[model samples]
Target chain A: MSNKLLLMGDEAIAQGAIDGGLSGIYAYPGTPSTEIMEYVQNTKQTAELNIHRKWSANEKTAMEAALGMSYAGKRAMVCFKHVGLNVAADAFINASITGVNGGLIVVSADDPSMHSSQNEQDSRFYAKFAMVPILEPSNQQEAYDMAYFGFELSERLNVPVLLRITTRMAHSRAGVQRREGKPQNSLRLPSDPRQFVLLPSIARKNYRKLLMGQAAMEIESEKSSFNELISGNNKSLGIITTGIAYNYLVENYPDQKSPYPVLKICQYPIPRKQVEELYNSCNKVLVLEEGYPIVEEQLKGYLNTGKPVHGRLDGTVPRDGELNPNIVAKVLGMDVAEGQPIPDVVKNRPPSLCQGCGHRDVYEDLNEAMKVYGTGRVFSDIGCYTLGALPPFNAINSCVDMGASITMAKGAADAGLVPAVAVIGDSTFTHSGMTGLLDAINENSPITVIISDNSTTGMTGGQQSSATGKIVDICRGIGVDPNHIRVVTPLKKNHEENVRILKEELAYQGVSVIIPQRECIQTFARRKKSEKKESND
Target chain B: MKNDIILAGVGGQGILSIAAAIGLAAVNSNLYIKQSEVHGMSQRGGDVQSHLRISDKPIASDLIPEGKADMIISVEPMEGLRYLPFLSNSGWLVTNITPYMNIPDYPDINEILAKVKSLKHHIAIDADSIAKEAGSSRASNIVMLGAASLFLDIPFERIEEGIRQLFGKKGDEVVQMNLKALRLGREFSEKNR
Candidate 1:
């Protein structure tokens, strides 16, 4: 008997890793990827299978921890969104040179169209830069099968594999078949004792080895069973699809019959043979890729291609935004009913802070305190408070990356933007804001840093934050003057005191951190329910 | 048989719980299901939706096609109407008339109901009052699901069993309250019919 369960793409990866003998899954919470680690943590499989699953302080730490597990000769999987990859890039780029004893797979979930992200950066580019093999699955079953087989492939290739998925694949659910369980790798060190060590003498040789393996990696791609060529009756148009884009391409042809040759590419490195065959077979090619036109560019060549290549760069399909079945249908010259435009009565309803949230109190008071300083002085980081840029409050000015608020505020302060204030969240403060605070303290940048301590990662479904119960100590230990490290409960009752403290910190010259301490209302509500249940029992 | 439903509501309005109920029922009937949810930053009091597709055969795409949804089950009137583009021309629209007004520019309550009534196949009810009468107002999403269940091709017993399996952890009293809310909603729709 076989096992079939309805699982999201992220859950499929988690289950695949579990079935594939994953030793550990280390990751910081982020969209479309957070559920991967959460699934393992809440599963009985982790306990019975002796898998290590825990939330790390940040993506960089998580990446390094996965690398450490790989160093001990155990299979490891690190999952994160595209931006989190930016945080972990330092560790990722080096892992290519250091190679691995056991298999290591980095699953980067890209949010195309900026769904809950700052940018729609393609992670395949990162994988290409790192000079690693990439497995881009096209469906939920493929997502599962790739993870089930990805570890072995990584070990065989002796390099980390990048499994890139978009928001659609990660969040969507479909039934996935399971494979037989495998035993975890026994403890073993790398054959080269100094391989992991990045000393120049050993690294130079390792770099040469990595570069030498590129041709072999390309051969592996050409031989990958995931890559396929489907022949049709007619050869007027050839279609090249990678990852989820294949689903959309096939969706246009319900009976799976089209009058065009199709090269469905799930594994990367272009699979030169398959591309050459398709290009030689068809008159023109339509490249369907979710993100950048990387494949089209390569196929088009520097001087020009043999056949006209049509894609995002050529305006065959819109360069920006997501590719849907409707968009695919339009591209295929099929009839698509255009949905009516949104009624003018339906105004823009952007995301806002929850009612009675502690962040609301913090913002309400901060707006009052900054009335004299005017607008555009507050630089915010990613979190629920970023919504303060909306109407009712109109509080914060800028929100660049995860921890750019403090550093940006410092730079502005140096550039004569007086009273430049930085607003950040509890989880975000610990994520990357701490280092920037240290920099500000060292230079004594004239800025007031407000750390809205909500006791949990409020924006991401209230995950337990690393800064919980240690925000004050963290501020004090980070070299901020102890006397100036102010803490207040962000409540409607304490609005006056909160505003007064904000005023005081804004007036102060040196760096000051005002932590508005309050447990997130959602988590608090959950706690109350559990507490009441316990009392009744 | 196939059912494509768009479960709609504001973030934190318990639309997922409603989707879970239908998903559990669909799975128990041995039907294939694909549910795509909105996660991350937009979930913070923003418009949120889930596309739930159930079929006897294996499902292809996680998302339903435009103007092809069989029904729209929503916890808020505005949220339900927001997804009219996804509904087929003859699709059923079941929604709560209550406005969870977190936005500053929320429209007049009568205006929303009038628009909903314009649909040939629609059921607009105040799920909040019915849920409050049953037990807890948090079960309003369940009520909306019950009203929508009248139009689903799936059986009613499966949905009732689904509620039992979904709310099994919350104890009998809470479960009974939700069950009452579900039945109350069904009775109201039947009375209107």
Candidate 2:
């Protein structure tokens, strides 16, 4: 445990949580965030410490379950991607007002460059919106230290602390020193039971308390060693850096000395004292932050006394996508003398459906059936099958959120767009699509819900899907006609039959569910490999 | 003293296996290693590259700055070229002469090999055939690591030990197969380079 383990930022956070008295860590698998939970699940510590490490149906469930553990006075952590934060925002925002009985840290791994996400939304804004303190680590060691210290801050403030990280920080590996492990909290309920029950009367007072607590939170940020303004003799330009952006800035100066006075803000509620000193000491201020220019805008809005503040907003840095050291160098007026141009032979390689994938056959049939119905009528949800929206299939019209396909198709059907189709994967269906399907049944909308049952969450590395064996029953239970529910194995031989079935379903006057049942090819391969090993044994 | 390598391949082709082997060896040698990788949707048969930086001194950035990479070890031929921009002008390019034909517009296999052979600092090996000869088709990644090891500063014995440590859990036979694969690659590099 004392050894310096080379760990990804996500892995560091997981270890930090273990060392910080974590009783449970709940999450759904997601890009950039999946490794955090996977590390804990694979670790021997989960069993030794008796911590709860289980996948939830969705991010909201994970958030609420973590809050439930906090309500029992046990430190709990929840990790998810930035988009997953949107899914869990309801519970996340409400948890702030209710506050925590035990330490709780919500780790939202943001994809600033939209590397694997639909958008590049920052989670620090969520922290600000929820009126909670945020810890943004600039390196793997600090990522561990922040997780361990974040729990104490969460407990002391009686609120959930937000641990925000971006893709580079989440995926990049570096050596991290370990901290001493702590014991899990003994189960103890909140002193005031109604503190969580947000009845308007109680909620109003709690809301006021949260508002009145901002000053104290700001004072904590002011006193925090994590928020520091380092001294420099050259005061021509002041640099403000936060999160992984600090690494990019520091990387420009290999000697680790930026002649400019710098304020490195890792723990935030916007340390006004550091900002004041930085602004006063330098001629101009340059802000470096990943994602949206929230910090830059905040400084300009609240503290700007006519001194020029330059960042993403004013074009000091690119407005969109993640920040890199090269861009950082360019902004700092440092020369980047290296790097050759990519040759033309190296063509773009966009992600495609794997060969022999079940979704491939399904999309083929769906595209054939929909060709008669025409394009722009199919609404798909997020998953591997969202790849159908690409290439020769070009099968789906929209893929906005987890379950938006069914609901969006339903709305379109209601608008008299007959034969509207919704294609959603099994895991995504269970995540948020089931409720939309039920609503479609209630209205008897003329929409065909094609639930591609892959028997696992294929997109996020084949986790056990919530809808493994229950898709048909769930549809029937949702009040869809049992006769209209059809299940088919997605294979090339079944293409003609599957297309016929899809055509019939699209022609249906009421709610219909077409269940294309097949195990994901990747999962099948893994199972076959393991079974081969087992048989050899 | 240092090795800045870009491990390139299509997702699901197991470039990470090579990274894992090299990482284990680097750690065993007490060298600082920082590796940055691609995850998520790209795993659905897309182009992927991992930046692996190992040095005797402390490492700073996770990414290998362009034109600073000491070597390019690719499991796919075109994937090796895909990272050409990152490779230093004099860096070694060790690539498998196999084509992962997920894309319809994939350049001709011969064309890829021709370009690779055209380079003064290139070692082209049919790792798949070499791995199969070594007794396991999946050992191609190990063969890649073997080919790459010729350019690395770390000891070959440590990498062989790394293979044992990494694949020993799978079974002794599998570990032995990979060790054989690794040796085949080193022998190939010695003959060809």
Candidate 3:
């Protein structure tokens, strides 16, 4: 074993992919999951190992690039945060039916509790809907091991694997066992054109093959050591826990005296036979899975016995909230000591944009520009700038998802809404907004799409966006008239100019593209530090 | 036995690092520790708190319920008062008296000081001043952590060891500054008591 290093879950996934002999990694950076791609890109071993890493235009392009690599019979991986999955869902759902020529792993780090996200949608459900295997790791070590295994399983099953990690699993640090690196898979040219072609007839055949492959996958799951049956002294109670919840259960068991047998599952399409055997062996079965009761719900249908199943659905564990060790112990009939009461600590601290942030100045200018136009005329996209929807500056009226701003603005303009403006980040514009931009330009919709170009993917930790240097040209190339396009600096000193330009574009009576360019605050800080170091050297 | 500690401070005050150090110390002592942190826009000058649960056995929940903390360590006075509800009635509060209010509309520093004085087991230290004296304002967290050590049974040596391990890679200058800050904080808390 290499030196056992304490690594964050995100870093562990990156290391796991490297150890798993991934040949290509395509990703558009988003938080929690951003570190995975960044780690792989920065590691000295990447070039030594001949790994191909690139920041794609958007999640869809990233997903497609990964699929293309898998088509060449090489291990490929794509990563994005929870919402990025929405941008790539079209390709993601179809890829499940299309299967794969080689190993393919799609990692979606779900942000629970709305941390750095608009919503806390579980990605495991997406995996289930796509009829693919999903793996959720509880800690850094599991994240590493599962990611490695996810690749092998994907190749073995001839299907894409979804490795779903939550914010806790992505950011938390734990000691991980290092392993000797595996050699990259030998490349193989496409043997049959029909495999790549996803016509209805071919897709139907592949879909049936997917169904036929489920039984074998379940058998594989049963034999896999990742899911274990940990038996204790008590036969009356049993606990079925998976992912981080398993860690919570193990940690909460007082005196290590768990009265029940625990079938700890970290992989899914859960080994139903193992769950059944454990269920049959115990008097009462309790499910301790996180996110949704995917395991608990599935076990209910398969069980023939009269034993009652307890879990999220039954309210034994919380159905809507994140789990902790104390909650798990209470459900297990353990008497844990309650600590002293906490005093009232009331302080209302609202989220604020960073000091000297370019988004701040842009929002100020945009608000002024919109005031001239009318109220409720602006639609905003996701990014660091989404905070504009909050106090002091309510420049944006709607923010649903990536690229929603452009489409929503188009919709509002078509309905004769005056001075419709869509504000999106440069990264977001490439992610999913560009298509809507094209639509607006082609249809000559009377709207203004403001691309807040911070020269990076600002919200999710500053990963480079594919359209970093080409947004203006791309807009013009897509039939947006150059005369109608405007670019401005989102600096406090340039506030008046930015507002003036925005107002002019808003009144253009046609699709006008506005590019507000600036550097993200964090990126700017990092660059300053690097420059200082260079000067010192 | 479970030990619930609430570490609170304004964002950017290194409250998370202090909690992380405590969690690492507990883990090193052969105990099971579960830690949950709030992440979002909070790191940008908002109120920040981390829940650190250390037990000889397993911990069940990530959050310590209201009024259940064995100890509350506040890096800032206002931030400490904000998390007081998590502290047991008789629980100890170790905080820096200095006010580091990032947002406008902050309560008067005198009022905050008066409120803290009402607690039975309150130990206030001028951690910011100590850190400044130590030649690095960033070491205020270390100093506050040092002051909090007086109320806990965890050895000063363990904390010293943890600090060393955390700053060891940063080089000798940082290591020396932090060690000085920690020792000064410990001395200030002891003298006040």
Best by lDDT: 2
RMSD values, in order shown: 1.9, 1.8, 3.3
**Alpha-carbon shift of residue A436 in model 2 (angstroms):** 1.3
- Position A28, candidate 3: lDDT: 82
The TM-score, computed over Cα atoms with residue i paired to residue i, of candidate 3 is 0.91
Which prediction has the highest DockQ against the true structure?
2
Error of 3 at A178 (Å): 1.5
Quick one: how many clashes does candidate 1 have?
0
The TM-score values for the models, in the order shown, are 0.96, 0.97, 0.91
Off by over 4 Å in 3: A1-3, A190-193, A232-236, A301-307, A314-316, A329-345, B1-6, B16-40, B51-71, B81-92, B149-171
Where does the lowest 10-residue lDDT sum fall in candidate 1 chain A?
A338-347
lDDT of 1 by residue, B68-167 (tens): 7889898988888888888888788898998878887888878888888878888988899999999988889888878888888789999999999998
lDDT of 3 by residue, A1-537 (tens): 114565667888989999988999988887767888888999999988889888988888889999989989999999998888988999999888878887999999887667677777778889888888888886667789987777889988988999988877776654578777888888886577687688989888888999999887788778877788887778888888888887767765545446678898877788888888897888888888767777778777665346788888878888775676667778777675554333334457666678888888888888888775578888998777777887778777887988899999999989989678899988888878888988898889999888888888776667777778999889988899999888888888888888888878887889998888888888999999989978977
What is the C-alpha local distance difference test score of each model? Answer: 0.88, 0.90, 0.80
Give residue A498's lDDT in candidate 3 (0 to 100): 86
Residues A324-436, model 2: lDDT tens digits: 77788899887775645665677788999988899999999988888876779999989999999889788888989999999999999999999898999999999999899
In order, the candidates keep a fraction of the true contacts of 0.51, 0.58, 0.27
DockQ of 3: 0.33
> What is the Cα-based TM-score of model 2?
0.97
